[model samples]
Target: MKYTHTMPFGAAVHDNGVRFTFWAPDTALIALERNGLAAAPMTRDADGWHRLDVPDARAGDRYQFRLPDGHLVPDPASRSNPDDVHAASEVVDPQAYDWKDAEWRGRPWTEAVIYELHIGTFTPEGTFVAAQRRLADLVALGITVIEILPVADFPGARGWGYDGVLLFAPTAPYGTPDELKALVDAAHGLGLMVLMDVVYNHFGPEGNYLHAGSPSFFNAAHQTPWGSAINYDGDSSRTVRDFFVHNALYWVEEFRCDGLRMDAVHAIRDDSSPDIVEEICAALRDGPGRERQIHIVLENDANGAHYLERGADGRPLTATAQWNDDLHHAAHVLVTGDTDGYYADYADDPVAQFGLALAQGFVYQGQASVFRDGEHRGEKSDQLPLAAFVSFLQTHDQVGNRAFGDRIDALADPAPLRAAYACLLLSPHAPMLFMGEEYAASTPFLYFCDFGPELAAAVSDGRRAEFGKFAAFGDEAARARIPDPNAASTFEASKLKWEEREQSPHREFMAHIAQLLAIRHRALVPRLAGQPRGGRHWRDGEALRVEWPLANGATLQLLAHFGTQKASGIRQLAGQAIYTDGITTDLNDTLSMAPGSVCITLQEDNTHG
Candidate 1:
């Protein structure tokens, strides 16, 4: 029997059978072991790749690889792991699913109003099919893009997908591979571009079989906080690099995803020329991604400006944008007034820092990090376009990593939260919101996992120790109150309460968001899509003034007061008031704003008001 190979690796399905390919340079012997059948030896090439074609194998058939030591292991590039990560891999035909998004060309980064969500906690059913049913709700909420948390297979049914093991397979707990595709197709049908979060930094602690197949997969010299770093510059690095690049293409081409949000790219250590990230981005741009625009975003804690730098041709070097922690930290400190841990740096003159973050891509660019003992951090990003930064008030890490997994609304005053939301949505940069952020759902987004007893104890102890550094969680009793990651109730509690959207404050908040988004799409976004021609920001006592030159020969002005008392003596000279929240309604030469108020106005002239 013969099988046509579509991918360089993995289980490719054809009419006759499936073709299996594995790259195991360290292993001498390899065999294909199908369920309820004898093991068949596979032929190995000089490059250390083992291949075998089995005509009897079909879609839904379970199989594993037999090593020389007689140990059976799942495919390193399995497409579908119907069972747990430790179980056998199942064959899946990528062409079996009929998609209905033929006319869907993805939206650009400038028009993206990203909504990040975890499937398990997003819906009560916690399945891709269930989540698909709620796409219309998100579409109605003014979300142009959906950035889903990682969906790769993990050890158990529930976990924040950063700990995913099987890179190619969508977690079985969510739904079948085809069902996940359906979700993406449905989103495209509703004019929503879907982007998946892919983890290339490290694999989960459990169910990792890469070392068993090839020890060269990990670099022994470099050590990450999670474990040994991946071999991006060491021996046999070409194949190692290809594995990740191929995975990126697999998601884009097979799943019909518009983009990928690479998770924790700062943790990915690569010293070779033409860095792995650059290579991956180049591949995406040159491969199937060439047909449609694919936006690639990075989560880099290092604030590496090179990722957003443009070449001589004026094209970006690597990613389309990066998550701006500087913006989030400054905003969090200003609103919540929590000056512990990393937030300590922004404690001093947080308003000024927030203004800088809005004007520049990062406030810490080439500056000393007070939280790191005055160590210099971040590269200069002032020259980059505003679209190169992703600004958000709340994200999965910011909320779930908290001692009690509290959202911004839970920690800050209501007025300030509203002010913050207005600033976030109307800012020049791209903005993202957490799952229930639009309606302010009451459910907590906690960190929950389903590890075994031994690993669970270690994780629980480590989680407590991590928060112990904060003064608020220093008390042992407070630490004990933290939810256990292994508990089923912890995962259940994180599920969003969709019914709360009809409540009082929640419904009001939804209306506010809708109005903000309408103004953004109808007025601001069209004029400020890529970058602002010029911008200025200043701290006026407890209030902040931000001004940007619009593409239209007009000046956009935003005045926000974060102090408790009303801001008086503000001159009311403006063309049109686009948005005003919690401000005094006296039309005079002098304007007074209530505490935690924001006012945005567009003046035809460039003169200061």
Candidate 2:
């Protein structure tokens, strides 16, 4: 059939048939192979987009593209890869699913209490439908946002999703694309906004077919740790940029995702004016039916405060927020006293480092980074609103990338861990909790993959070699004990033991977290959503004092004693004890705090000099 269509750059179902469009500028000839049928020539436009409308093809029909070299490739924008990443793409009707969240306008960024979870390991079933069963639990726990790890189709049945190759297809193991939508819809129904993590820096090593059709998808001038950088600023960059920008919109518009967490944006490497990140944010904001406010966050190691800067029109140029590693690093060091690798920088004065991170958005703003060979890093972001930072005590990388996959709670004493949780929840920045972290589930989130034998061996060896540099993993015995990424048991071991949520210490921890979140909702969130009145932090001996004036005629003060000895007569009395972790007795002008204790007090005196 020959007709013009206004659908997106992927497989779209129409009243008569399924229309397929792909961008392959480097290919001379392209054809469509539908349901294992003979290859049919596809009409090509001057813009290098190949189009084919097959009246016989309908929803559930399998299709693949035959390149100039006669190699079949899955659609780059496939919505559902039911078989696997390398298999044929299935035609899906986007409008077929019945969504009940029509009245669901997403929550604002200021009220976000994100809980990051890996879908595969979140539940025993490890599917979207299964994960949806726990949404009510999160709602009860006061989680406003749920940040799921990447769902893009990868090589095998299980992975961390960082190795996703088919960016559009939700992994088959987790369930169908419609099921994934159901999960998002269910979350929205419970008043929870769902944000998905997307990796655009580089495609995965396996099952990547973009190069078979067009080399312009990647840039030779730039390289990232993962692989070649995407051609965002190189020749034929506009098409490459559009491919990803459409993917972002696909999730937001088609899947009804509330937001996205762009992974490793520092590796994007664009020198062009109004960088690719800016283009993506603008496109998302200007998308069709832009009624719901869309939020974009960045996971940037560079601490790029510019990503959060507003343009002349007073809208954020790139992302609404960036992950604050400075806060995490300082908090980790303070709680565990571990000064290895990047944690070395925060070791000298963890409290001071954390204080700087609280007062400013970054601790390394023009300061020498001891881990980076004394190189000055980061830019000033103190003027930005606290909502521009996402702070957490533990994250996927912080916990899973460890040699033993030990969480902060596993490494620290209960007293300090509780204190750290108070700091994270009460901080001005938005706080996130890793899966199973609130109750301290004993399951270790080890790095697992499902690569073939050869790639699996290589991954196992590379993992060992990477961690071998650390003294903890230097011993041959310890190195041998590292979980093999290829092992099914390793993947199974990472699953959360939901039963533990009702156990002794786990129950206590959950209650504490619930109380802390209640306090945040009652006291902190209101003040945070208002005009950005700046805050202050100071250190006295081994104790830290943080005070921020609220919209009401009161000030919020957090007094934390990080030293081993008890701090006596730390500070004067306050209005009310909003939250306390390890403090005992009422507070007067001469209150004492046990070691590793934290108290959050509300002082009625807002005019303190």
Output the number of the lDDT-best candidate: 1
Taking all chains together, each candidate's TM-score versus the true structure is: 0.96, 0.95
Candidate 2 residues 105-223, lDDT tens each? 78778789999999999999999999999999999998999999999999999999999988989999999988998999899999999999999888888899988887788887888
Clashes of each: 0, 0
lDDT of 2: 0.85
What value does the lDDT take at residue 453 in candidate 1? 82
lDDT by candidate, in order shown:
0.86, 0.85
Clash pairs for candidate 2: none
Give candidate 2 regions above 4 Å deviation.
1-7, 310-317, 531-534, 552-554, 584-588, 603-609
Model 1: which residue pairs collide? none
Candidate 1 Cα errors over 4 Å, as ranges: 1-5, 311-315, 530-534, 585-588, 603-609
